[model samples]
Target: MMRIALIGTGNLAIHLVHAFETCNATQLVQWVGRSNTPPKQARDTPYFTQYQNNMDTDVCIVAVADDAIPAVAKELQHIDALVAHSAGAVSIGELEPINRRGVFYPLQSFKKNAPLDWKSTPICIEANHGDDVILLEKLASQLSGSVHQITESQRLQLHTAAVFTNNFCNHLLGIGQSITTKAALPFSLLHPIIRDTFEQSFASQAVALQTGPAKRNDIRTQQKHLSVLSEADAELYRILSKSIFNTHNT
Candidate 1:
C-alpha cells in the first residue's frame, strides 16, 4: 500500500481526500492544513497545522493554491519522499530543493461542497524521473480512470482551453439566466436547449453546430437582440455576435 500525505484544505484537497478513501491500495497518512480546524470528512486521518520535515509517507501531495506551492515545497524538501503539486498551470520546477518532484493536476473545476465521481475525472501527471512518473500513474489510476502523462507546456495549454470551454460557457449561462429572469420566465425553460447544445457539441464540431442570427449573418435579428438587452448585456451580445459573424461568414 502507498502511504500519502496531503497538504491543503481547499476544495481540491477535499475532493482528493474523498477519492483516496475509496482506494484500498492508498492510505492517507496525514492532512496538513494552515489551521487546526480538522476537515469533517478527514476525521480518521491525522491533521497537522504545520509541515513536518520528516513525514513517513511514500509521497507528499501539495494540493494548495498555485502561489503557495513554492513555499510549501521548500518546507517539504527535507522529507525523503516524492513531492508533487496539484496545479495545472504551475510547473514541476516549483517543487525545487526536492530531488524527486512531480505534478498531479486534476483537470476539473471544483466546488467547495460538491461531490464528484472520481472514475470520470481526468488526472494529468508529470515527473522528472521515469520511476516517479510510473508511481504517480499507479496512484492516479487507483483514483481515476482517465489519466495522462503531460508536460508542463501541454498542461498549461489544456488549462487555458478549460477556462475558455468551461468557465466562459458558465458565465454565458449566467447571462442567459439573467435574461430569462428579467422576462419573468423560468430558468428551467432553457434547460432542454442547453442540454441539447452540449450533447450536440460533444458529438460534432461546435463551430459546425453553430446557429442563430450571427451564424446566419441576420443583421436585423442581431440588432433586435442588442436593442432588448441591458447596456452591459448589449455590449456582450454585440461582441459575441460580431465574432460569430466573422467566424462563419469570413
Candidate 2:
C-alpha cells in the first residue's frame, strides 16, 4: 500500500483522512500539524504535530491554509516525497523546486457539522508529469467518480464561479429570509422556490431553466420588488438582476 502523510487537521483534512483510510490501496500513515489538532473523536490512527517526524511517509499531502502552503513547501524542501496542496486559486508553480508536486483540490464547500459522501465530490487534479497526473487520478477515483484535469487558469475560473454560485447565492438567500422574517412571515415560504431552483437546474441547463421577473424583462414586477426591499437589499437585488439579465442576453 502507498503510504500517505496528511498535513493539516482542518475540515478538508478530516474528510480526506476518512476517505483515504477506507481506500484499500492507500495507507494513511501520519498527520502533521502545528499547535492545531483534530478533535479526539476525529482521531482514528496515529498523528504527529511536528514536521520533522512527518518525513517517513511516501507521499505528503499539504492540506493546510492557502497562505501556509509556501512555508510548508520551504520547510519540507529536503524531503523528496511527492508534495500536493488542496488549493483552487494557487497554481502548481507554488510548489516549485519540489521534485514531485501536484494539485489534489476537491471542489466542494465543507462544514464540520455536516456529513459528506466523498463519492459525490468532484476532485480537480493537475501535475507536471503524465505519471503524476495518473497517480492522482487513480487515488481520487477511489473516493469520487468525477475527476478532471484542469489547467491553473481553468481552476481559477472555477473558483471564481463557485464564489458566485455558493457564497453570493447563500447571501442572497439570507437577505430573503431576513426580509420575510421582518414582515412576520415564515422564511419557510421561500424554501419551495429555492428548492425548485436548484432541482430544475440539475435536470436542465441553468440558463435554459432561468425564470424571474428580470429574466422575462418584466420591468413592472422588478420595480415592485425593488420598492419592497430596504435600501441595501434593494441595491443588491438591482445589481444582481441587471447582471443576470446581461449574462442571459450575451
Candidate 3:
C-alpha cells in the first residue's frame, strides 16, 4: 500500500482522510500540520509537527487553504515524493519545481460531521508529468468513480462555476429560510420545494426548469416580494430576476 501524508485537518481534509483510509490501494501514515497546532480531537491519526527538511511518504497532500499551499510546497522541497494540493482555484504548478507536483482536488463542499459519499464526489486532477497524473488518477479512482484530467484554466473555471451553483444557491436558501421564519412560517415547508428544485434541475436543463413570478414576468408579485427586502437586497432581487428572465427568454 502506498503511504500518504495529509496536511491540514479542516472540513475537506476530514473527508479526504476518510476516503483515503477506505481506499484499498493506499494507507494514510502521517497527518502534518502547522506549528503550535491545536489538539486533534477529531481523528486518531499520527501527526507530524513540521514539513521542512524531514519525513517523506509516497504521497504528500496539502489540503490546506489556497494561500498556504505555496508555503507548504516550499517546506516539502527537500522531500522526494509526489506532492499535491486540494485546491480548485490554484494550479498544479503553483507548487515549485523542486518536488513532483499535482492537483488532487475533490469537487465537493465538505462538512466536518457530515458523511460524504466518496463515489459521488468528482475528483479533478492535473500533474507535472504523465506518471504523476497516472498515480493520482489511480488513487482517486479507488475512492471516487468520477475522475477527470483537466487543465489548470479549466479547473479555475470550474471553481468559479461552483461559487454560483453551490455558494450562491445556498445563500438564496438562507435568505428564503430567514424570510419564512420572520413571517412565522416553518422553514421545513420549503424543504420539499427546495428538493424539487434540485430534482427538476437534474432532470432537465436548469434554465428550462426555472419558474416563479420572474419566469412569467408577473410584475405585481415580483414588486411585492422586492418591497419586503432592504434597499440593497431589493435591488439585488430585481437585478437577479431580470437576469434570470433574460436567460430563459433567450
Candidate 4:
C-alpha cells in the first residue's frame, strides 16, 4: 500500500480522510494538523501537530485552505515525497521548490462527515513530473472511478464553472427561500419543483426544461411579480425574465 500523509482538518480534509481510509491501494500513514488535539477520525491514525523535516511517506496531501497552502508546502520542502494539494482554484506552482509538486483536486463541495459517493466524484490530477502524473492518477483512480489529467488552466476553468453551478445556484435558492419567508409560506412549498427542475435538467437540456411565466413569455405575470418585489429584486426579476424569454423565444 502507498503511504499517504494528510495535512489539514477542514471539510475537504475530513471527507478525504474517510475516502483514503476506505480505499485499499493507499494508507493514511500520517495525519498532520495545526491543532494539538486531532479530530475524532484522526485519533487512531498516526497524527502530528507540526511538520517533521524527515517525514516518510509516498504522498503528502496538503488539504488546507488555498491561502495557507504555500506556507504548508514550504514546511514540507525537506520531505521526500510527492507533495500534493486538494485545491481546485489554486495552482500546483504554489508548492514551489518541493521537487514533486502535484494537484489532487476533487471537484465537489464537501460537508464534514456527510455521506458522499467518492467513486462518482471527479478527481482532477496534475503534476510537475510526467511519472508523478501516472502515480497520482493511479492513486486517485483507486479512490474515485472518475479521474482526469487536466492542465492547470483547465482545472481553474472547471473551478470557475463549479462556482457558478454550485455556489451561485445555492445563493439563488436562498433568495427564493427568503421570498417565501416574506409571504409567510414554508420553503418546502418550493421543494418539489426544485427537485423536479434539477432532475429534469440532468435528464435533458435545461433550456428545454425551462418553465415559468418568463419562459412562456407571459408579460402580465412577469409585470405582476416585478410590481410585488422590492426595487432591487424587481431589477433582478426583470433581468432574469428578459434573459429567459430571449432564451426560449429566440
Candidate 5:
C-alpha cells in the first residue's frame, strides 16, 4: 500500500481525507493542518500542525492556499518523498525545492461535507521527473478515473477557463437569485433550465448551443431585462448580453 501524508484542512483537503480513507491502495499516514485540532476525518491517523523536515510516507499532498504553497514547500523540502500540491493554477515548480515535486490538481470545485464521486472527476498531474509523473498518475487514478499530464501553461489556461466556467457563472447566477428574491419569486424556478443549459453544452460546442434574447439579437427583450436590473447588475447583464451577441454574429 502507498503511504500518504496530506496537508491542509480546507475544502479540497477535507474531501481528499475522505478519498484517502476510502481508497484501499493507499493509507493516509498523517494529516497536517494549521489548527491545533485535526478535522474529524483525520480519525485514527497521526496529525501535525506543522510539516516535518522528514516524513515517513511515500508522498505528501499539499492542499493549502495558493499563496502559502511556496512557504509550505520550503518546510517540506528535506522530506524524502514526493511532494505534490492540489492547486489548479499553481505550477509544479512551486515545489521545486524538493527532489520529488509534482502537482495533483483535481479539476473540480470542492465544498466541505459535499458529496462528490471522485471517480468521474478529472485530475491534472505534472512532475519534474518521469517516474514522479507515473507515481502521481497512479495515485490520482486511484481517486479519479481521469488524469492528464498537463503542462504549466496548459494548466494556467485551464484554470482561467475554469474561473469563467465556475466562479463567474456562479456569481452571475447569484445575481439572478437576488433579482428573483426581490421580485418575490423562487430562485428554484431557474434550476431546471440552468442545469439543462449547462448539461446541454457537453453534447457539442457551447457556442453552438447558445440561445436567449442576446443570441437572437432581440434588442427589445434585452432592454426590458436591463431596465428591471440595478445599475451594477444591469451593467453586468449588458456586458454579458453584448458578449453573447458578438459571439453569435461574429
Candidate 6:
C-alpha cells in the first residue's frame, strides 16, 4: 500500500481524507495541520502540527491555501518522498526546491462536512518528470476515474471557466430565490424550470434554447421586470437583459 501524508485541514483536505479511507491501495499515514486539533473525520489518523522532515511516506500532499502552497513546498523540500500540491491555478514550479514535485488538483468545489463521490470527480495532475507524472496519475486514478494531465496554464483556464459555470450560475439561483421570497411565493416553484434549463443546455447551445423577454428584445417586458425589482436587482436585470439582447441580436 502507498503511504500518504496530507498537509492541510481545510475542506479539500477533509474530502481527500475521506477519499483515501475508501481507497484500499492507499494508507493515510499522517495529517499535518497548523493546530494539534485533529480533523474530526480523521480521528484515528496521526496528526502533526509541524512539518517533520524525517517522516517516511510514498507521497506528501500539500493541500493548503493557494498562496501558502509555495511556502509549504519550500518547507517540505528536505523530504525524500514525492511532494504534490492541490491547487488548480498554482504552477508546479512553486515547489522549486523539491526535486520530486507535482500537482494533484481535483476539479471540484469542496464543502465542509459534505459527502463526495470520489469516483465521479475529475482529477488534474502535472509533474516535473515523466515517471513522477505516471506515479501521480496512478495515485489520482485510485480516487477518480477521470484523471487528466493538464498544464498549469490549461488548469487556470479551466478554473476560470468553472467560476462562470458553477459560481456565477449559483449566484443567479440565489437571486431567483430572493425574488420569489419577496413575492411570498415558494422557491420550489422554480425548481422544475431550473432543472429543465440545465437538461436543455446539454442538448444544444444555451443561446439557441434561450426564450425570454430579453432574448426576444421585448423592451416593454424588460421595463416591467425592472419596475418590480429593488435598485440593485433592477441594475443587474438591466445589465443581463442588455447582454442577452446584444448576444443574439448583434
Point to the candidate with the largest TM-score: 1
TM-score, per-candidate, Cα-based = 0.96, 0.90, 0.91, 0.89, 0.94, 0.94
Error of 6 at 110 (Å): 1.0
Model 5 clash tally? 0
- Model 6, span 66-168: residue lDDT tens: 8998888778878888999998778889998999999999989899967788889999999988998998999999999999999889999998988988998
List model 5 lDDT by residue over 1-250, tens digit each. Answer: 9899999999999898889988999999889998998778888878899866555688899999999999998888888899999888887888868899989889999999789989999999998889999999999999988999989899999999999999999998999899999999999999999999999988889988888999999989888888899999898888988899998888
The 10-residue segment of model 1 with minimum total lDDT is 50-59
lDDT of 2: 0.83
| lDDT comparing candidate 5 with the true structure | 0.90
| TM accuracy, model 2 | 0.90
Q: What is candidate 4's lDDT per residue for 129-163, written digit by digit as tens?
A: 99999989989998889999999999999999899
Candidate 4: worst 10 consecutive residues by lDDT?
50-59
RMSD to the true structure for each prediction, in A, is: 1.3, 2.1, 2.0, 2.2, 1.5, 1.5
**Candidate 1 versus the native: TM-score?**
0.96
Regions more than 4 Å wrong, model 4: 215-219, 230-235, 242-250
C-alpha positional error of residue 191 in candidate 4 after TM-score superposition, expressed in Å: 2.6
Candidate ranking under lDDT, highest first, comes to: 1, 5, 6, 4, 3, 2
Better of 1 and 3 by TM-score: 1
TM-score of 5: 0.94
Which portions of model 5 miss their true places by more than 4 Å? 53-55
The segments of candidate 3 whose C-alpha lies over 4 angstroms from its true place after superposition are: 35-44, 52-56
Choose the strongest candidate by lDDT: 1
Alpha-carbon runs more than 4 Å astray in model 6: none
Each model's lDDT: 0.90, 0.83, 0.84, 0.88, 0.90, 0.89
Between the candidate structures 1 and 4, which one is better when assessed by TM-score? 1
